[model samples]
Target chain A: MNLVQISLATGFLLILLGLYGALTNRDILRMIVSFTIADTGVNVVLVAVGYLPGREAPILDTIPVAEAASRITDPVPQALVLTAIVIGLGVTALMLAYAYRLFRARGSLDISEFTELKW
Target chain B: MNFTTRKAIPLVLLLLLGSVFYALFAGYTPDETLNRSASYYASQTVQDTGAQNVVTAIIVTYRGLDTLGEVTVLFLTAAIVGLVLAHSKAPKGRSGSGFLPSGELLTTGTRMLVPVILLFGAYVFLNGHLTPGGGFQGGAIVASAMLLMLLSDSAERFSHRLISRIESSAGLTYVILGLLGMLFAGGFLDNRILPLGSFGSILSAGAIPLIYALIGLKVGAEFSSILTSLEATEDSQ
Candidate 1:
């Protein structure tokens, strides 16, 4: 397969692996880590979708500005991915904080241990 | 749930999801050329925003308001983390006092590398418009320095008030720059408030470098705040 296909497959596989780990794991920390892996997969897929087989990065530092459109890959997805990565980090940190609070509250990290919200 | 069902649920769900993904992968076709907005940015980045990095141009110029909101979200996360962990923070004067001493090599290495890391982070954000690195990447690098310090020295106590000050001021300045863009140039957060200087140079890209520098500081502060909040939890143990 080509570079795009290979990367796309890798990204999807990572997402699946992360999802399986998250769903099967009982520990809150493990779930957080699994979700981070999934988040990384999403970023990789976005970047792969924006990839052009035979093109340079979308930076004008090296390439001539006049030929940028033909020479560079798409910058939109990359920009979106950058934002997504940062927001993902923020979300992970928030989740970690919540987990810490939960542990403090009940002295347990198991997801099943906290059933206050369960219907 | 029963043990068999618990194990089988994820497997069955994954199978269904995997099939969906397979269909998407089979049907997917890479585009030969840029889409409408991507093409616009590719062709017009240098002329419009004076940023050599088109991604930087899009993040800081074309989608500046979104960036502002992203920073706000980071700020909120940091604040909430601090608030949530505040009760567990070690009492004053008792923080960072009880841990075993870090070895000489780590301490010396961290001391030597921290300054260089801080400088590199500043350089990355300052040269954001000209290079692949930008505010977010630079800010993360800055936070790494803080992480290193915390790791190497158990007794190292960061001034929380100072970090918050930097974060607040940087965020405030970023918004002001956006307002300035509205007043002096095009719409909000336009980088053309100052003259788009000579291309490929550090000084080019108008207000991009300035705005990115502020973002770097703000992000760095937020990350450091989060790190300290987590680190201080060791005292609760």
Candidate 2:
């Protein structure tokens, strides 16, 4: 299909792959990586959804200001994705910090090892 | 549960989810035009904010409060990482014992690249209103300099006090600027507190460049703090 559709498919496939990896992987670090993959997939989907058939980026540097609405793809999604990417990075860092602490405490990186919450 | 079932269950679930995604992909149709808010930003960015980049205008002006919250979240993440890793830190005297010295090439490359990276980051944030880059991207770039330094010299110790001071001061100034906007301009975080200036120049877009510069500093400091804290734990290993 079109570029947008291809990107959308790729995004969906990435999400699926990530989810599958997270579910199958027992290592905490692997799970974290899987989650990041899924996070990236979500971001891709968002950007793809914002894409127009044939439009310039939402910057007015090249395109005239008056024609922006018709000329540019939806900028809202790009802005939202920017925020998402940053937040995702913070979350990943926090997760890694927690994982390091966990590894230090228990000397294990396996997800099944930490079962404090399990009933 | 059994190992086979553990794997099988996820496979089954993903199969179902994949079908759902397939349906969504099939049904999805691209929009023909900008939605209301998108159009509003596309049109209003010139007269209202005088920023060449509509995304910067929206982030630094229209949605400033959200950006403030986002920065707070990063701060909290950095703080928590430091807190979490504090007890595991290596003693000060034994900092560089274990790791082999990084080669001369990496050391020299870092030395050569770091200042340029820092300057580029500053440039990106400073001209955010007129270009594609902004505070977050610039801040991340600045943090990458710290990353490079750490890689070259694993034992490189950063002054936490200095980093925290920069971070807190930038954050405080950002808030004060927001309040200044409320007092002087239309509302909180209004870029119009100063003149919007001539469009497309570095000085245009009122306080966006200034606010973004502050954001870049704060974000860079926070990311560097996080990186430093993580690096500190390396010596304990």
Candidate 3:
């Protein structure tokens, strides 16, 4: 009914799709992409939690006179989100690079075939 | 097959376990009410740092140590990329062919967007002290611009030597500035060396913008070099 509930529903659906893709897809690259999608869904939920109705950015100049950032989106959440984005990017890049190498070495993108690592 | 299910189960279980762990243990908030907006650090960063951006506040001030670690990671990645690319021997004294994928619009669009991206990236880095963008974000943007150039105009080549030099020197400068901060200023990585000019000015931020600039150049060069090496490897193969 409310905006948060709608966003929560969408995010939950996205998480389910990501989980399905990560499971059903055989390609390692697709699995990684699915992982990213799931990560993004979680981030969306975190950001939604910070949303405050009718509150401006917490910057002093942006806030109205005598009216503080009541129920405004939390800056802490925003900052945390930014850091999470960076870490996600780093991890994604690393995964892709490794996937590329795996494809080159094994001539296949499927994770099921990567049993050479097991002793 | 059974093998596929086995592989899927580990990854699925890992993700589930990690989420459960996070839900259980990661609920600690700061004992102090450290609101990121309109806080002491923000004021200090604006007044004393001369940075036009507050995101630069957290980047260059409150979480500066984290920034240092990030740069170190970038530096390490660049080094490893260089090592990997170098080991794959092709031919000496040549950067090999620069064959771009066809369709003129991509190249044209790249040429058009490259400057805009560079300009915006510069703006982001310069205004990081007062705005939402900071060194890392802007630096990545600049790198993206370089990647665009690589992708669009395959003929536009970047030199490995130049790339290596930029990466090393910029990283070196970051550490040295940090040391200088420790020796002379309040502590390590302090922006107390340069005169914090009038707030909101380009020249403001004790040395914040300069640091961001170094980071931008370093990231741009490092990433471009990595892309270049990959292209070359693909060509050779």
Per-model TM against the reference: 0.96, 0.96, 0.76
lDDT of 1 by residue, B18-110 (tens): 999999999999999888888999999988988899999999999999999999999999999898888877765454524566689988999
Clashes of each: 0, 0, 10
Candidate 1 wrong stretches, greater than 4 Å: B93-100, B154-157, B234-237
Could you tell which candidate, 2 or 3, scores higher by lDDT?
A: 2
lDDT of 1: 0.91
Give Cα-based local distance difference scores for all models.
0.91, 0.90, 0.66
Per DockQ, what order, best first?
Answer: 1, 2, 3
lDDT of 2 by residue, A1-119 (tens): 88999999999999999999999999999999999999999999999999999998888999988888899988889999998999899999999999989998899999888899988
Cα distance off (Å), candidate 2, residue B105: 2.8
Candidate 1 local Cα displacement, residue B122, angstroms:
0.5
- Residue A81, candidate 1: Cα error in Å is 0.7
In model 2, which residue pairs have backbone atoms overlapping below 3 Å? none
CA displacement after TM-score superposition, residue B220 of candidate 1 (Å): 0.3
The residue-by-residue lDDT of candidate 3 on B22-46, one tens digit each, is 4532452322333655445434544
Report DockQ per prediction, comma-separated.
Answer: 0.89, 0.89, 0.22
Q: Rank the candidates by lDDT, best first.
A: 1, 2, 3
